[model samples]
Target: MYDLPSEFPEEPGLPDEFHDLQPQLLSRTLRLTAYSQENWFTGTDLNVYYDPTHVLWHKRPDWFLALNVPRLYNGDDLRMSYVVWQEQQPPHVIVEFLSPKTEREDLGRFYRAQDRVIDPRADQFPPPLAPVNTPPSKVEVYEQYLGVKHYIVYSRYTRRLRYFQLVSGRFQEQTLQAENPRIWLADLDIGLGIWQGNFEGVPSAWLRWCDRAGNWFLTDTEAAQQRAERLAERLRSLGIDPDDID
Candidate 1:
């Protein structure tokens, strides 16, 4: 029942240079130490279908992470789109990269701080249906319909990050430090925070994951370079220069 087409005639996401690299950094650094790699799945610019009734009503999040779901669809082929009901899992966390066209909706311009109530239970899923033609904003989809535990939005232009956690079936915004902002999700034994560094040779503040120790997780390339550096140091200690090798 979940065999939904992933793409449409008109693509939904607004992608630029930052859009391309930011999601890559998120997925690459999302290391859940407690869960095996195969037990977790992360999607980049992938369609997430929320309503089984309105199969086409979906959101294409910048990046989303679902836990305890097979890396492959049904342990078979790659998923064209994430059908929430079919997978029997809502995204544990969803992230959106704010752009000029999306910030208002992403930050829920519809509601104010006094309007929402904070709830500790974040289990509101299978939300009431909206008119197929008149769908809610992106934040509503993730906060209300999907009941995603964590909702993160970041703006590269402003170097500002916003975090919302689903509490008592409603999403409540969290306070963040002005510098070295971090969030610790006990459920995943992982934390996400802003890191100021050069990635792929571009110096900028990027959202990255960290362990309980607050050490940022490295991307595959960074890990490889780290290993090579350790090996070079070992070789030098043995009176052999790794750089001298052909």
Candidate 2:
């Protein structure tokens, strides 16, 4: 069993606005008819401890979703960090928003077996253990250790979305058809894709969840605005001034 850290460090540097807004969008739009909110856990920028052996080793995903996990730990307490050994459930899907500094690691291109320098003092130790120099990349941790079902990487710089599915113990990149442009997540019964439009007053590409029929879910604000417009239209059809009624 792994022990939780007494205190996890705050994420370094000033927070980027996109990082904050993007995860919020994902969380808000995630709707599963099959499972209640209590049965699902969604996290953003939260530490996830995966390796029981290496207790302190963890990964902080930009956003992630775990099915069949209590939304609140013990049904009352909020989780400080997600410990895989204790939870006994892995994240069904993990998404990473790529930055220039983290692009290589997020894509699994930073892993180098040759770069691992084993400790030379292992032979003298009673429990003979060798320490590796370089930590495993984020992709390696998710694909090899955690066995996350789906791993997604979105590059705001390139405005491109990439998908990877774990198959036969490895991650295989899934293709996005140009016609559809959405990756279907069978487990969650939803699709994920990039939506080009203004979000939160910013004109940029944002990741969004869509239905099987290719209908993008609207955010709470968007839904409210839409409702208001429909009401105004109905009032106009009835030969009444909606603005005057308001």
Candidate 3:
């Protein structure tokens, strides 16, 4: 059902500066959020639809999030793509990596203008200005319109971060506390920040590795596995062994 246009130019692959690190950053951030919250979903590079037209579309953020949904689809697997029209909900947050090509769209004005010219099938898509009691804040509108909350724009070029939150039908920029390098999202009770560390002897900003003390970096699934193993070992040490029960 989801197909790219033949006339649509080939998706320019992510530039060398962004190809690897950006994905890793997005993945780790999503993992951090999902691990810390319940009934919340986080994804990277999943399809997302905001307008009813489904005609105007964008493919996944560096990372995106939806709150109050099953962490797993059907209780097992993560979602591959989010069709806002199909899903009927907006993501609570979105993160956009700054690249020369897409900084404008992520900032809101670009997509808004593009959406204006889209000639949406009104029947298929709701009127842009249809009044709703709780019209999202400008930032929230990005979630409502783009199905993303807490729009995050990060500049690899500058290593700087900017975050916006939806409030009372408008967007407001949030400033970070000097003590905390992470951006705080009160909605999710979590924070996102760059971590400088070593992984497999390669210095990388977003690495998923564990230390001897059983503390871990950003390996989501791996962290779960480690937790399970720790529990099993603890049970055995207490003589409440699974083998004995069997």
Candidate 4:
């Protein structure tokens, strides 16, 4: 089992710890109000095969969501990978968390740009594109081939979120409001926003799902804790010392 990794050796660094944690947060809080849980699927670090013509070519997105698909692959086994042709559906949303190695590819920039020392071209835009024969970039695969409707890029370092929507066969960057950067995906009937809280015993801002009213969904552990607290309070109200019994 250890022989084959979901993210091949070629992919950078095999992803960091935050990569593992962030996608878990997204998966836990994801409540597809538009469809039944049995009808949708989500994958983290899953290799998605897009082009049937070039069967070997694939893109490994950090996280992706697909609608009207089986919760389990073929309603039984967990998916090893997602094949677009076999599934007959492309992902509705794709999210990438920025890393130093993948920032340029994920952001569709010709040059790497982050804080600290730089050589030249402080404010210059992207340069020319590579030849068609070369392997397509992540953005190119998502935008042109897969045609993902909603593309999100987030930076944990800066706590910033960037959104892109497909329009007229092209990906257009959406302007996030200065005050409220939270995005409400109306079609999915679920909102995604950053919340500052404790998760997995760590306190930090996490990308989580919320309702239109801005209430973040509780995770399994959180829900369980809430239930236990309510039970304890009820016992106290009934004049029973819960701590003594447990």
Candidate 5:
């Protein structure tokens, strides 16, 4: 007698650890973009086609941002995936939330600043990736190929943030800050931060926290709602109807 084979579940696109908090990172990224005045786009499943030979296919960043792009291109979706050659724009900022497998690549230690740009003038701002006299590495070459400006890696294991800025065509490490902390996107004039809040009935770390509470903090939307609720309650207490405010 012939027997049918038992069905097995399809394998996940990423490993268990990467899948866990990836959604949280994407959600925060979208929320931060919405908080900004300019429009921003993000995707989790899209493939970034970097190499024209179709040999190199990089999956989505945990989050990425490009400023001054139109909401839509040619009446089609802004992008199916970011094609550097086709789109002619590199991501202004890219962030990777650390997973065990990809942490090393995200924070490439061998990347040095002197390797990225050509010395047309011979006297430019210091290269971004390395101090003077320091030779660049494979990571530096990879970044030069990608044309990335700011690359960030946040460690869930350590709960720390590391930042690299592309200055003079090479990336330079900068001290990550939290005191009056803000992620200043000069192109958009916006910032990103963590906000403890509820989402889908669960407390989560949201990306935008625009107000201070009594030793607590609230997001811009949350704070607005609180203000509205308080004003309504005050009107009720004074026997003045909120509906009267037209």
Candidate 6:
């Protein structure tokens, strides 16, 4: 067994407010009717170790889901990181929130030549002799290494969502329904779309999960609020003051 890295380098920087709240929303609303809670695991900003040969290499996704995996490591301990070799299960869906710093890498725009040379003196030889320092982008890691099935990217600034599905061993960009801005995941029996409204007291377009019927899944707080509203409505119909009772 390969020993996991105990001290990984600190991330470049911390995420902003939107980054923190958005993933919370996704984690809270994700519900699979068919699969029990124990059958899946959701992670946010967690290291996902993919390559066994290079155990140090990892990607920290904004949010990801791994089906048929215990929520805890070995069904007991919480996972420090999701090791692909150890878990033997890759994420089924991965979501990325686009920011200025990660836009190009998230979109797989960076490429490193396979035959790049390392010696500085080789610069006199040709362009191919120059050392390539570019590492694999998030897209490359998901598509080639982890083989993630669904890759979704949402831009809060543009209010645009891009969906890609792994088909025939490659990721194909999916077309969105112009009438309704939502991408349906048949396998998961849910859809993802940009919802505009106040979430956690901040009003903006946020990424959220929707059911097959196009109903937005509610977070725990939202669900509780809805229940209270329904109770208040029922009390009013019976000519009782709900506020006064409480």
Q: Give the number of the best model, judged by TM-score.
A: 4
lDDT of 5 by residue, 1-246 (tens): 012112213312243443444444444434343444334455444455555654343445656665445545433554556665665665667776654435545567733342222324436433233335433332453377676777766554444556677787788877646653345445444455554556446565544423222132343455688999999999999999998999
Question: Model 3, range 39-138, lDDT digits (tens) per residue?
Answer: 7676665555555544445454666667666677655765656656655557777777655445545566424332222222425533233334533333
Give RMSD (Å) of candidate 4 vs. truth.
Answer: 5.0
What's the TM-score of each model vs. the native?
0.86, 0.82, 0.58, 0.87, 0.60, 0.84
**Which number leads on lDDT?**
4
Candidate 1, residue 65: the lDDT equals 94
Residue-level lDDT tens digits of model 6 in 153-233: 877766767888999889998889765589888988888888887888999888888987778999999999999999999
Give the poorly placed runs of model 5, Cα more than 4 Å off: 1-39, 110-142, 178-182, 196-200, 204-224, 227-231, 237-246
Model 5 deviation from native, Cα RMSD in Å: 13.2
Poorest lDDT segment (10 consecutive residues) of candidate 1: 117-126
Model 1 CA deviation exceeding 4 Å by range: 1-3, 9-12, 109-132
| Superposition TM-score, candidate 3 onto the true structure | 0.58
Q: Return the lDDT, model 3, position 226.
A: 80
Clashing pairs in 4: none
Best-to-worst lDDT order: 4, 1, 2, 6, 3, 5
Better of 2 and 5 by TM-score: 2
TM-score ranking from best to worst? 4, 1, 6, 2, 5, 3
- CA shift at 197, candidate 5, in angstroms? 4.4
Candidate 3: which pairs clash? 136-169, 137-169, 137-170, 138-170, 138-171, 139-171, 143-147, 143-148
Model 6 spans with C-alpha error above 4 angstroms? 1-10, 109-135
Candidate 4 TM-score over all chains jointly: 0.87
Error (Å) of candidate 4 at residue 20 is 0.4
Clashes of 1: 3
Inter-residue clash pairs, candidate 2: none
lDDT of 2 by residue, 1-246 (tens): 224673444433123799999999999888898899899999888789888787788888989999898899877888878988888898889998876445656788532453222435535524313346655778889998889999998777766678899999899988887554689989789989888878878988889999998789988898999999999999999999898974
> What lDDT score is found at residue 123 in candidate 5?
63
